[model samples]
Target chain A: MPSVKFIEHNGTEHVVDGTNGDSLMMIATSNLVPGIDADCGGECSCATCHVLVDASWVDKLAPATETEESMLDLNPDRESNSRLSCQIPMSDELDGIVINLPEFQY
Target chain B: MTNIVIIGGGQAAGQAVASLRQEGFEGKIDLIGEEPSLPYQRPPLSKAYLSGALEASKLLVRPEKFYQDRDVATHLGSPVKHISPQERTVTVGETEFSYDKLLIATGGRPRKLTLPGSDLSGIHYLRTLQDVDNIRAHMATAKNLCIVGGGYIGLEVASVAVTLGVTVNVLEMESRILQRVTTPFMSDFYHQLHTERGVHIHTETTCQGFRGQSGKVSHVLCGNQEIEADLVIVGIGIIPNIELAETAGLACDNGILVDDHCKTSDDNIFAAGDCTNHPNALLNRRLRLESVPNAMDQARTAATNMLGGDKTYATVPWFWSDQYDLKLQMLGFSQDADAAVLRGDPGTRQFAQFYLSEGKIIAVDAVNSPKEFMVAKQLHGVAVSPEDLANLDVDLKSLVPST
Candidate 1:
């Protein structure tokens, strides 16, 4: 089973087992993890589920499409590591992924 | 601790609860939801949920435990009878709950067509979860579904029906689909897409009445033409639920009117989401928006003011719709635009149409082109000539002025 660690802005961490077909937003939210709003319900339309990927695993994740990049650009606090958690599909290869939820999301 | 009461069981009310908890408001939060279930997403009620691709649990804004854990008392399936602003109490039957602050997020209801045979057994309107459940149940034994309206709801249902192998016929009174909300380019794009999917689209046609058999809708009458239909779905429009605000002596127009801070006429009361007619400084006009983003954003603003924090909601309005794998994202309002420019070709199924008023970008409707929509959202009211926009060499990112 794949596991993803979600770190909140206040340093609270929640490591939950991820389902293969679900997005990170879905896993974090369904597990009652705080700070992942998924206000648009994993539609990739709202960037509220914005997360900063750990620097070490940035190269391993799939690159965001132009549409996803547009949504990320709307976030004022967006950095090179910023990704909409809804766009990242959970898989066995992406286990042990670490994502930092932004302060603005709360 | 203050007693904060929230009315309505839709996205606005649910988001308000989440916002209050996120803001650390440890008050006695009372959520009065008219529906039996928890606050769920309405958008999927027509698409994924209706098609059975999305589960009912996924539609909830938050799990039931979230509210229970926060000590937020929830009253589901209870309709608020009346509100007394002077007494600061909301009445649900004989029970009266006092509140220091109140939020009215009643949202809206679907407008029903009152034609002759409108009360037929097989006719349905897509608004609530129950409404879609009824439609989904009917879809099992129904074929040749007739949809009356070409708006987002109508089109979304048509998409699902087509996927379910149900023959669909869409009747639009307007000349094109989405005439009231989108540009002709977008309308034509969707028209072509749906037509290619084997859905019959009838434009400039009005459903005069329904022809029924045994109190069930069998066919639809449109100016002497009777189209066979085993089931019928109406998605005309919605009327904001504002009777409570009006009865409470708050100002009401087409919807409950609110200022920039989401405060109503009375200081103790606040209104947000689809039930609100709010002033948008960016658009330089007042309008009511029905979208998830609008509901969530205004709920945040209303929660802030409810907690004694002054925050104004003046962001650019944005909306999105998913139909047959195409995602259309619109930014700002495009009403009364003088000119429109096509940024890309619709044949490719990914393009954007920029709406400009007197050489200034007012709004944009992007089809699977989120980058263009993002650029338009940032430069919403900035003056940019159509010629400059048409130039392929010029980057939309460069047009955005750096803060």
Candidate 2:
């Protein structure tokens, strides 16, 4: 199982085991994390799963696809490092990646 | 002077902006949105947009010039990064914007399947212009399509697919289609209608995964069964965008928590649309709704409050879904109704299901009958006896005020 570290908006940290093919949004939502609504169930249509990638590892994450990019346009908070967690698939390489939650998703 | 900022470019946000302006508020108005285009309506995305009955240009809630003409500073493609309640500011990228009032109208997204091959090409979720564009291109050549989930989106898309001479198979995890929302009568009516149209429907079946060929979906795996398809659409449900609210120290339960006034924990900030959980006065409890009626009503309330007006959004919630020739419209909330009054024959396809709770009309589910729905909406608070509701000869309009 791939493990990912999540640092919530309140600075609470928790490590959760994620499957290789699951999305970061799914892992966070299933773990009952305070953030990461993953509304739309990992579909890039909704930007509720918006997360700010750890600036240091932003390059390691894949670039936003056209769908994700278009959806991000509707997100409340748009950042250069902002990525829809639903579009970010979990993997061993992203184990230690950190994401910051936005102040409003809907 | 109050500085009002709205974060969204959809119908709800548009309504809020318009309401605020109409209320004669002489304040700073900032409309920050991620969409490059102006605010638009989403209900048509699954229907008219797919059938070419409506153009993309007509979907916009207002013309581009309207924003400038109305003095609404529109920020296209700019996402709000963070909100500092203490500082009364919101950050978008490197720029920090100040606001005395904030409205969060971020909407929901379409739910996707977790099965394998979901990442393959030709899989679609209809929520925006680009999504419609991609699906429209494939729909031109698509012969067979598999729809996972039997909700409104799936059914609406299936209706369009069948009309285009495409074979559609709808797979539902529940025992009946639309099990979560509609009554069994409505569900059976729809199931029969779809089945009669030669649609292949599999109920109580879970999608195991998907099989792909050449990076495109070819088959859907359901337990030990396999169904062939050229396109796949998953419409399980939507999740409210609550991360931003939760992160900002706002109360969230299924959605951003809001009172009747659409106010969040931070009085300076408010929320509406599919991303909010508001107190439904009719239900006497907090509930999250996905209907356009709820969104627009909440928007109005939020706008009034933003303009320093004392108004509460306590309107009865309503929703509608168009499938094939049937238009299902609902009024109020019915999740806890103890009795239901049938106005007409369900088998005939024109009737209204009036849900009653403790001898009062709580909610109504009408199919192909808007007059009854309108009457139900008007008589929402008036106590009507079920015996009178069951009588067909009695004029329902008489039960409530005219107009």
Candidate 3:
């Protein structure tokens, strides 16, 4: 199982083991994380599974495609490190990665 | 005074700007949108907009002058490329505009198929005026249309296509149409209704690719079946625009995560509409809804918070889709409902299916029954005895809140 760390807006950190091929959004949702809604079920249709990749892990994550990029543009707090967790499939390479949860999702 | 800037030309952004002004905020308002025309309603784009019953000009939520009259600096056709939260500014091409508060209502884009022959001349995805124009032109000469998805957009477009003497074929990858959003009973009701109307629906069908002639789509290849088509409308779904949010340093979840107050990680910024994910009080969980009601409701909540007013948005989720002569209205989340009670005849296509969980009304999907829908919306989350619901003379409205 791959593992990832989730850091909340208030600086709380949670480390969880993730299933392979499961999206970061699914990991957070399955864990009942307060954030990470994943409303559109990882279809990239909804931005509910947005997360900010830790600066050090930014290069480790894949770049967003046109569909993901267009969806991110609709987000209010778009930033350089923002990535929709649903679009980021979990793998061994993403182990030990850290993500910051937004304060609110809607 | 706070300087608030909103991006996107849609109902959500327009409502946010107007709500801000209505709330007595004397802040500088700048509405930057990529659409060359004024903000308009998109639901009609797949329905009335294609039927010629609604003119493009009338689709505008408010006239062009309405923004100027309301003291909003409107920037039509301008798309924001970057955001500097540290500097409280957004850069659109060569122009850099500053803001104390920002709202992103960039909305969504229709998903386009990338299969072979997808770039063919007759293939299209409905998202904007340009797509609508192409579809309208094709409608004039086309006789058969193959819709790739059986969701709201596909069904609504089929409704219009059938009315205009066009033969329609809907392909659904799932065994039943609307399996993701609706109950099995509701799906059966709609399936029967469409079948009776001479519409051919193929379930459990997977599209292999498209066959084209002279750069124009001529057939949709699904398994061993070749569906002849003059036009193909793909309504797979939409992706929310979150690139700008990700480019900035804000925290993002499935959407720009906001608390009950609609504030993102940054206190100075907010997100609403289809680009946000917030907790649904009624569902007792977090969700991202794409309906117009959710968008408008969240925009108001974001606007209020931007003006120093803290208000938590907690409304029951509801959605309505019109197809042919049937109007399907659904309320609450039915994903977990264990039992569904039918209130009318599905054969007639005029009924309501109430989804129940632990003897509580969790959701309701009504077809051509506005009265039942009205009652169901009020009965959401309420503990109702199944016996009382089955009784035809019982007035459910009497049990709801006064307000």
iRMSD (1 decimal) for each model: 3.8, 18.1, 18.6
On residues B1-403, what C-alpha lDDT tens digit does candidate 1 reach at each position?
A: 4899999999999888888887889879999989998888998888889889988877888677778878989999999999999999999989999999999999999999999999999999989999998999999999899999999999999999998899999999999999999877778889999999999999999999999999999999999799999899999999999999999999999999999999999999999999999999877789898888889889989999999999999987888888888888887777768889888788888878898888888888888877777778667778986876776577776776654
Best by DockQ: 1
Q: Tell me the alpha-carbon RMSD of every candidate.
A: 2.8, 19.5, 19.7
Backbone clashes under 3 angstroms, per model: 0, 9, 41
Best-to-worst order by lDDT is: 1, 3, 2
Better of 1 and 3 by DockQ: 1
What does candidate 2's lDDT look like per residue over B1-403, in tens digits? 6688888877788878867876788788989887787887777788878888878875666556567767889988997788778898878899888998889998877776666778889888877777888899999999889999999889999998898899999999999999998878778888998998878889999988888888998998998999998898888889887776777788889899988889998989999899998887766888877777677678878988877788888777777777787767787767778888989887777788998887778789887765567567657766787877878787665575432
The numbered model that scores best in lDDT is 1
lDDT, candidate 2, at B7: 85
**How well does each candidate reproduce the native contacts, as fnat?**
0.49, 0.00, 0.00
Candidate 3 lDDT over B261-346, as tens digits, reads: 88888888888888887887767789877787788778889999898898999988877787887767777878878877777777
Between prediction 1 and prediction 3, the one with superior lDDT is: 1
